[model samples]
Target: MEKNKISVTSDNIFPIIKKFLYSDQEVFLRELVSNATDAVLKLKTIVELGNFDDFIDDFKIKIIIDKKNKSIHIIDNGIGMTKEEIKKYINQIAFSGAEEFIKKYKTSNIIGHFGLGFYSSFIVSNQVQIFTKSYKKNASSIFWSCDGSTNFIIKEIEKKNRGTKIVLFLNEESKEFLEYNRILKLLQKYCKFMPITISLSSIEDKEKETIINNINPAWKINPLQLSDKNYLNFYHELYSHQLDDPLFWIHLNIDHPFNLTGILFFPKIEKRIDIQKERIHLYQNQVYITDNLEGIVADFLSLLRGVIDSPDIPLNVSRSHLQSDPSVKNISKYITRKVADKLDSMFRNHRKDFQNKWENIKIIVEYGMISTENFFVKAIKFFIFSTVNNVYFTLDEFKEKIKETQKNKEGKIVFLYSSDKEKQYSYIKEAKDRNYEILILNSPISVHLIQKLEFSYKEICFVRVDSDHIDKLINHKKEDKCYSELSETEKKNLKNIISSNLMENYKFSIKLENLSKKDYPFLIIVPEFLRRIKEMNSIGKEFFEKDKEKYYQLIVNTNHIFMKKILKETCEKKREKMIQEVLNLTLLSQNLLHGKNLTLFISEKLENLTKK
Candidate 1:
C-alpha cells in the first residue's frame, strides 16, 4: 500500500469542495454517474475504433444502495484505471482525464470536461473508495480511498471485473442518500436520458434491479427515423403529469455553427398568465444539466417544453448553470428561427389544422412576436387573428379584408377587439351590427401584445369594443354631426345631477349625444388609453397603479325616451328617481354597481314593479 497527499494548491480543498462546490448537495449523484457514463462511452469509442479486441456485450452502470452500511456504490463496466493512471488522474486536481482521452482519440462522445466532478462526492460522503481494474492485458486492479482529507491510500487489489466501482460512505447529514426512493428520484431526474443503460438496486432487494435511464432518448435519435407517434410518446415520457397532449412540436437538429439537438413542444395553454417556464430542460451530451435555461434560451421560448442537448453549450465548473458565452446567444437565435420556420410550414401546408390549434398556441406565438424582432418578422406570415365568430386571418390578410370599411377618419386601420365576449356582449353586438369584425383579445398578456402590435404596424390601432361607442370607435367623420338638442344650461344641470350620485372612487365625464333611439338611454365607456394603462397595471406593471383614480365617459343619449321624459317631468322627486334609475342601469351594464348602490337599484326596481 502507498499513501500520499492529493496534489493541490491548498490543503483545505476538500472542505471547499464539500461546502461550496455544487449548488445542491444532491448533484453529487449526477456528477458521479456522469463520470461513469464518460468512462463507458470512452471504452465503447475505443472498441469501435479497433483499438481493443476485448468487447463487452453488456455495458451498463449499476447504482447500489446499502442502507445498513449507509453507503452507495456507482459501478460501471467501462475503461477503468490502473495504479499509475489512477495516480495521474485521481491525485491531480483539475486535470481532466476525459479531455486527454478525447484529444487522443478525436472522439466527441465523452461528457466530462471539468476534472473536478469527482470531488463533488465529498459533498455528501465522509469517505470514498474506488476499486478499478483496467481493460489492458495483465493490468493489476487498483484500490483507492480518501477520508475527506488530502491523504489517500492506493494499493493493488485482487478484482476479477474490468470496470470501476465508486463507494461513498454517507456523512451524518447525508443519510437520506441511502434511502431507496431518494436515490431513485435523483437518478430519474439527472440520468433519465443517459446514452448508457443504468440500473438501481438496493441491498434489501439485491436480486431485483430496476432500470432507471432510457438508453435511447428521442432527441439523440435521427429525426428521419422518428414518426409522429414516436415524438408524442417521448413527450409523454418527459412530462408524464401533463394530461393534454401538445398541439405540435419542432424537431431541432443542427450541426453547422454549433452542435444542438432537441425537440420543443408547443403546449396547449389555457391561461397565459399561468404559463410555466423552466420546462425546457438543458443537457450536455445527454446528461441533464438544468431546466432553468435563462441565459441559454430566449425568455419567450421558455414557454416551450422539451429537451435541448448541446455539447457546445458552455457550463460553469460545477455544470449547474450556464455561463455567458457567444455560443449561447447563437443557440438561442437558432432555436427561435427553427420554431418560426416550423410554425410557418405548418400554417402553409396544413391551414385547417393550424387554425384548429391556433387558440391553444396563440399565446406562445404572440409572445414570441412581442419579445423577438426576428421571430416577429418570420411569425407575421403565420401569426393569425381570430374573430369572435371563429374566423382566422393573417395580419396582412385581415388588413386586406377590412381595409374598405374599418379605416377611421385619419386613414389608420382600426382593429376592434373584445376582451370578454359575454361581459361586453352589447358592445360586440353593436360593432357587428355595422358589419365590423371584432377580435377576441382575451389573453392575460393581450394588453402588452396590443401595444407591441401597434408599435410594429404603425398604421393600425387596436381599440377595445367596450372602450367607446361605435361612432367614436370607428371615428367616421359623418357621425360627428349628431349632437344633443338641449341647451347648454340644461346639459350642465343634468351632468351635475348624474355626477353627484356616482361613487367617489371613480370620476365620470358626462357627455350628451344624439345617438340612435334604438340605443340604450345611457352607455358607460372607459377611455381606451386609461383602460389600457389600468389593464397593464393589473398585469404586474405597478408604475401606473399609483393613480388610483378610475375614469369613465358616461354618454347620455338625448334621443332616448327616458332622457326626454326626465327633462320634461314637473315633479322634482319623480325626475330625480328617473335619473337615478338610468344611472344605475348604466352602472350595472359596466359591472361597476356593487354593495349599497346595487342593493338600492334592485330594491327600487322591485318597489316600482309592486306598485304597477
Candidate 2:
C-alpha cells in the first residue's frame, strides 16, 4: 500500500466540491452512475474495435444499499482501472480519463467529460473507496480510497472479476441517502433512460432486486422502428400519472449539425392554458440533465412534454443548468421548426383529424405562434380558426372566405369572434343572421394571440361579436335610415330620460343609432379596443384595481317602438319606468345585473307580469 496527497493546486478543492461544486447534493449519485455508464460504454467500444479478445457475458451497473453498514456500493461490470491508472486518474483532480479514452478510441459514447464526477461522491460521503480490476493481460487489481481530503491510498490488490466497485460511506447529514426509497427515486429520476442496464438492491432485501433503468430507451432508437403505440407507451412511461395520451409526436433524429435525438409529444392541453414548465426533460448522451431547459428550449415549446437528448447542448459544470451558447439557440430553432413542420404535415394530410384535435392543442399552437416569430411564420400555414358552430378553417381559408363581405372601409378583413359561447350567444346569433362567421376565441391567451395575429397580418382585424352593434362590427360605409320622425330635440330628451333612470354605479356612454327595428331597443356594446385591453390586462394582472370597472356603450335603436313610446308618453313617471325597464334588460344581457339590482329587476318583471 502507498499513501500520497492528491495532486491539486489547492488544499480546498474537496471543500469547494462539497459546498459549491454541485447545486444539489442528490446529484452525486447521477455523477457516479454516469461515470459507471461511461466505463461500460468504453469497454464495449474496445470490444467492438476487436482490441479486447475476452468474451464479456453481460454489462450492467448495480446499486446496492447497505443500511446496516451505513454505506452504499455501486458495482459495475465495465472497463476498470489498474493500479497505475488509479494513481493517475483518482489522485489527480480534474484530469479526465474519459476524455483521454475518447480521444484514443474515437468514441462518442463516453458520458464523463470532466474527471471531477468521481469526486462528487464526497458531497454525500465522508470517505469513498474503489476496488477495480482492469481487463488486460497480466493486469493487477487495484484498490483506492479517499476520505474527502487531499490524501488518498492506492495499492495493488487481488481480484478475480474485471470491473469496478465503488463504496460510499454516508455522512450523518446525508443519512437521507441511506433510505431505499430515496435512492430508488433518485435512480428513477436521473438514470431511467441510461444506455446500460442499472439495477438497485438493498443488502437487507437482496432477493428483491429491481432493474431501475431501461437499457435502450425509445428516444435512442430509429424513428422507423417505432409505431404510434410504441411512442405513446414511451410517453406514458415518462409521465405515468398523466391520464390522457398524447395527440401526436415528432421524432427528432438529427445527426448533421449537432447530435440530437428525442421524441416531442403534443399533449392534450385544455382551454385553461396551464403552461407547465420543466416538462421537457433534457438529456446529455442518455444521461439525465436538468429539466428546466430555459435556454435550450423555446419558451413556448416549454409547454410541451417530452425528452430532448443532445450532446451538443452546452451545460454548466454541474449539469444543473444550461450555459449560454449558439448551439443552444440553434437547437431551439430546430425544435421549433420541427414542431411547426409536424403540425403543418398533420393539417395537410389529415384535415378532419387535425380539426378534431384543434381544441385540445390550440392553446399550445396559438401560444407558440404568439411567442416565437419563426414558429409563427411556419405555423400560420396550419394554425386554424374554429367557429362557434364547430367549423374549422385555416387563416388563409378564412381570409379568402370573408374577403368579399367582411372587409372594412380600410380594406382590412374583419374577424368576428366570441369569448363565451353561451353568454355571447345572442351576439353570435345576430352576427350569424347577417351571414357572418363567429369564431370561438375563448382560450385564456386568445387576447394576446389576437394581438399577435393583428400585428402579423396588417390587413386583418379581430373584433368580438359583442364588441359593437352588428352593423358597426364591420364598417361597410352604409347605414340604415331611421323610420322614426322624432326631431333632434326629441332624441336628446330620450337620451336624458334613459340616463337619469340608469343605475348610478354603472359606467356607459349613450349613443342613438338608426338601427333596424329588429335590433334590440337598448344594446350594450363594449368597444373592441377597450375590451381587448381589459382582457389582456386580466390575463397579465397588470392593471390598477380601481380601473377595473366594466365600461360599455349603450346603443339605443331609434327605429324601435320602445324609444318612440318613451318619448311620446304624456306621463313622466310612466316614461321613466319604461326607460328603466329597457336599461335593466340591456344590463341583464351584458351580465352586469347582479345582487340587489338583479333582484330588483326580477321583482319588477314578476310584478308587471302579475298585473297583466
Candidate 3:
C-alpha cells in the first residue's frame, strides 16, 4: 500500500477545521454530509459511464446515531475509494482530493470540488474512522482512523458493499451530534434537496428503521410539470405557519451559462416598507452556505424567501463570502432583470393580479427602481401612483390625465403632493377646487425618487401641498390688476406691526392682492421650489442643503379681511396692545408663533375671555 503525508506542516490543522473552516459550527454537519452525497453522485456518474461494470443499486445516503456508543455514522452507497485512492485522499488532509478526482474524471459531471469538506468532521468528532470497499474486482476493503491529531492509522477491513461509511466518535463538547432528533433536524436543514436519497435512523415501537430524505425537491424539477396547485403545496411545505399564500413565485433554472436552480417566493408582506433582509439562502451544490445574502443578491430581492443554488459562486477559505465579486454581481444583475421582466410580463398579461399584488410587491419594485437605473427605466411603465381619492394610475397615464390641469407657469408639469393629509387638508382641498390632482408622497424615499424623476424626465416638477396658493399652482397668463386700499403710510405701519409680533426665527412678509373677501382671513404662501428644497433638506438631502437659500418663501396676504382690519386699527389709535394681539393671532394660525410670544399670547387671550 502507498503512503502519503498531509500537505500542511502545521499541527494546528484540527483547530483550523474546528474554528476557521466555516462560520457556524452546525454547518460542519452540512459539509460532511454534502461530501458523502457528492461521493454517491460521482459513483452514479461512473455507473452511467459504463466504466464501473458493477451492479449499482439505487443510491442513498444515511445517518446513524449510536447514543450508547457515543458515536455517529454517515453511510453512503457511493464510489468507494481503493487503497491507493485513500492514501492520496483521506490521508492527505487539506489536499483537495475531490478537485483532483474531478480533474481525472473531468467529463463525468462530478459535483464535489474541494477535498477539505471531509476534514470538517474534526469540528465535532474527537476520533473518525472510515471503512471503504472499492467497486474493482478482488479489491481489498480498508479502514482509516484519525484522532484529531497529526497521527493516524490505516489497515485492511471487512465491508460487504462497494461504498463508504464514516464513523465519528463524538467529542465531549459535541455530544449533541449523537442525539437522534438533533441529527434528524440537521439532515432536514442541509440535505433535504440532495439528489441522492438520505436516511436517518429512527425507532418505532422499539424497532430501529431508517427514514429517507425527500430527494426531488420542487425547485429541481421543471416548473411546467407542476400545476399552480402543486407549487402552492410546496410553498406550504416551506412555511406552513405563515398565514397568507405567496403573491408570486419565480422558478429559477439555468444550466448552460452556469448551474443554478431555485424557487423564490414573494410572500404576502404585512408592511411592505419594513421588508426583512435575512430570508434568501445561498447554496452551493445543494449545501446551504448562508442566509445573509445581502452581498450575493440585490438588496431589493431580500424581500423574497427561497434558496439560490449555484456551483459557480466562488467561496473563500471560510465559506462565508460577504464581499463583492464578479460572479455575485452577475447573479445580482440577473435577478434584478428577471424580477423586472416578470413584473412587466404580469402587467401585460394579468393586469388584475398585478394590481392585487401591487400594494405588497410594489415595495420591491420601487426599491429596485430607485437603486438600479436600468430597472427604473423598465419598471416606470408599470409603476402605479395612487391619489388622495384612492385612484391608481401609471406614471405615463397620470401625466396624460392631468396634463391639462397640472402644468405650471413655465409650462412644466407640476405634480402636487402632500405627506400628511390632515395637516395639509385645506391646501389639498383648494388645489382640488381648481380641478388639480394631489399625490400622496408619504414614503421616506419620495423626495429622493422625485429628485431622480426630475432629473430623468424634462419639464416635470413636484410641489408640496402647502407650497403656494391654488391660483399659483397652475399659472394663468391673464394678468390681473393689483390695487391696495391702504396708502403707502398704512402699508409701512402694517409691515412694522407684523414684523414686531413675528417669531424670532421667522420673517413676516406682506403682499397685497385684489382677491375677493370670500378668501381666507389671512393666507400664507411659501414658494413652490423653496418649500420642496426645505422639505428635502429636513430629510437629510444634501443636494437641497448645498443650495439652501432657495428653500422657502413665506407670503402673507394683505388683501384678507383680518389684515385689512389690523391695518385700519393700527392707523386709527396706534394701540400697540391690540396690534400685537392681532398679529400674534395671525402668526399662531400659521404655526409660527412660539416661545415667549406664544406663551404671552395664550395668557392674554385667556384673561380677556375670562373677563368677558
TM-score of each: 0.94, 0.95, 0.83
Off by over 4 Å in 3: 1-18, 51-58, 100-110, 202-213, 269-272, 275-278, 322-324, 479-492, 498-516, 523-555, 569-612
In model 2, where is the ten-residue run with the lowest total lDDT?
A: 540-549
The local lDDT score (0 to 100) that residue 122 gets in candidate 1 is: 92
Clashing pairs in 1: none
Give one digit per residue, the lDDT tens place, for model 2 in 1-612: 999997656486768877898989899999999999988998999899999998886899999999999999999989998888887788888889999998998877788887888888998898899999998888899889989888888888888998999999999999999899999999999999999999999999999888898778899988888888989889989998888888889989999799999988888787856647439898898888877888777788887899999988887788788888988889888988999888999899999999989888888888898888999889899989989888888889999999888976687999989998989888988888888888889888998999998988899999888877878777654454345556899888888887777647576777888787878898887788887777787643446234443467888888887888887798988887777777778778778678997999899788989994
Candidate 2 vs. true structure, TM-score: 0.95
Q: In model 2, what are the clashing residue pairs, if there are any?
A: none
Candidate 3, position 180, lDDT: 73
Query: Candidate 2: lDDT over CA atoms?
Result: 0.86
Per-candidate total of colliding backbone pairs: 0, 0, 1
**Of models 1 and 2, which has the larger TM-score?**
2
Q: lDDT values of the candidates?
A: 0.86, 0.86, 0.73
User: Mind giving the per-residue lDDT tens digits that candidate 3 earns over 479-550?
Assistant: 542355667787677677666654454554555454545556455656665555665676535655454323
